[model samples]
Target: MVGFLGLFAHMAVIGVDTLFAVSSLVISNAITRQIKVGIPVWFCFAFGFAFTEWSNVRACWNDGKEGIIAGSAPVFPLLCIKLLLSWMTENKEAFATRTNAGDNTTITTSATSTSSTSQTGDARKAGGDINTNSKTGDTTKTGGEKKKRHLQLVKDNPDLEYVKEKAKEFYRKNGKWPGRPTLQRIAGCRENHARNALRELKGAS
Candidate 1:
């Protein structure tokens, strides 16, 4: 619809030559952009095209007003306003999507941090094989320490499929790639396992 309007506006300005010569080029460019970039970019292009067409039409009409151009009909600026509104609506939708994704990420991060802190406290209370360095006096978790349920050595773990699904779900929600730690927390798997699964999932994608 936008393309048709743009072509019509351009036709009114540049005559039939643009309709024949430029239309094919425009269609090809639109297809390329739609395939490579996305639909949002096309909306941006539509807004720009509408603006350009409106400017040209108004300029021609101005020239006619000053007796500089002959047979230049006055055009209503409603089309440009409508196009501008459409662009604004598209921007708002994009902004809302980003905002939702950011919110999900923030909430997930906060919950993960809190869960980690609680698990660490529980480990300390239960004396889960923490080692204290003699020189630095820093307590470090030992190899036997298990804060979260994870199958590190099980290559054929059934949770691997579940983790992959959750990883994709997280990406869809967050509008970004999930990190190893985030995937581990989401899928309740070991960081290494989550990392490997995410790698495979990304490769397949």
Candidate 2:
């Protein structure tokens, strides 16, 4: 009876650890944009877990003496790997594409608008009509430039269109589009692709 209880305890610990390890790998891979790397990592983790559990069971069969001893040794290492995987996954960027240009564009536009507004006081002091005309021209130019940028982003990422189409089809069939994580599973494309595609679609409509 004591041996049987120990066996059950060993199995429970191994089962929980395996669950955490597998889930960690899945989430980590999804977040890190390392889906390709993640596949092999998952397999390795699976094999490792299986091996550990087999060792524990084997030790248990011989005698209950080894059950806790064999199982405890691997638990810490598996947990540490799981923790590292979580940290790396969280810190890693989802998309590999450089978003610096997009960020710079926003900063530049903001600076330009602030400067223009500062200059507006001088223009208005000189004449109300002149200030109004200048502001209108600036607004028109800014609007045109933003439109061009958005169009370029869409043109460069044609895959975004396919994602949108697929999302719509999924929604029609399933009655709802999958969440970001599930969508990420469909293809290696990051969340940015989905977000950008949605933005473009809304703008077009």
Candidate 3:
């Protein structure tokens, strides 16, 4: 009966250590958005505890000393991992909030300017039917011409729109838009799309 109790204790220790390791990996990945960097560390610490516990189990099985592997050994590593994950989560939240706020301000200003320009244009065209294509020399201002122009713009400025959309999506997803530098790194824009957009908005105003 004593030997059976000892075996149960050994199994219990192993089970608890395994659970700790799995939980650490899950929490770290969720907070850090890093599966590659976090998973390996989790495995390393888990294996370390497992190694020590297995050694103790073997010793017990051979009629050697039991309870040599203290619960504290695995508990310490688990605590450290949890602390690191918490720090990462806090940082991510702060950064996301700040980025989102800035992006929202910029977007709001641009929208207001654009809306003013559109209002002015509507007032001016109350009597005169102003033809949009007259200024651009786009004689073929039909649906086909408009579609072609839209496609051409996308083809010419492939990365510009892509970067803008990505930044917008990032803000939507994380509640923080990416900085210009990060957008440049990811999207590789040569000219400033935000500045161009601002100019267009001002013209419309």
Candidate 4:
């Protein structure tokens, strides 16, 4: 506990935002190792910031000296990485299991359908062909509509990719993602475009 308190004091010397940024990268890296998928670094930073701030506030209440000793500054952020990593690993495994089960079901159904079709030959060929064509046409129409909408979005935000790369670089340097206003200044894009770029970066795969 004394070692942890010393660590927190050192973190305090480094400043809260900077420490949080470093913590975010650490948390993101740890989670990626466990789950094979990384979370947004900004998310980890935000979580650490909130936790540290709350801990500081609570400890400082009633003129308490333990505010700095409460281990919230940087220690909790480091400790929580393990917790978050475990949580992510469990959730990811569960999702993978469910996805694999779904894929197996789909394959089984497809195989059964193929075998039945082979046996029936021409008996249901006309109906099956019609249904297949209808489904194919509907799928094609939906895909085209989606493509058109995506194209319009891209047209509206020509600087999106550029802003996204800049935002990533900012995160790498500062340990936090820039807000829309900062993004605008850095990317030299319009306010609305900056906002859209930030959204795209946050939702990026």
| lDDT winner | 4
Candidate 4 yields a Cα-based lDDT of 0.72
Distance (Å) between predicted and true CA of 63, model 3? 22
Q: What TM-score against the true fold does each predicted structure earn?
A: 0.25, 0.26, 0.28, 0.33
Worst 10 residues of 2 by lDDT: 149-158
Off by more than 4 A, model 4: 1-14, 35-55, 58-84, 122-205
Clashing pairs in 1: none
Candidate 2 residue pairs that clash:
none
lDDT of 4 by residue, 1-205 (tens): 1244777866763575576768666766767776343466556566657756665666566666565456445556555776776787769979899999999999999999998888789768878999999999999999999988755544344657888888899999998889987876677666778888778778873
List candidate 2 segments past 4 Å from native: 1-46, 49-97, 127-205
Candidate achieving the largest TM-score: 4
Residue 182 CA displacement from its true place in model 2, Å: 99
TM-score for model 1?
A: 0.25
What tens digits encode model 1's per-residue C-alpha lDDT throughout 1-205?
2345766866654553244234434544544344344555545445555554555555567555554233322222433444555566557768889999999999999999999999999899666444433323432343234422244433444577888888889888998779988877777676677888888988987
Q: List the residue pairs that clash in candidate 3.
A: 117-204, 117-205
Stretches of candidate 3 off by over 4 Å are: 1-10, 18-81, 126-205
Over 44-141, each residue of candidate 3 has an lDDT whose tens digit, in order, gives 65765665556556555655344444523444666687687778676886889999999999999999999999999888796345554463455655
RMSD of each: 35.6, 40.3, 36.7, 43.9
With candidate 2 superimposed using the best TM-score fit, by how many Å does residue 7's alpha carbon deviate from the native?
4.7
Rank ordering of all candidates by lDDT, starting from the highest? 4, 2, 3, 1
Backbone clash count, each prediction separately: 0, 0, 2, 0
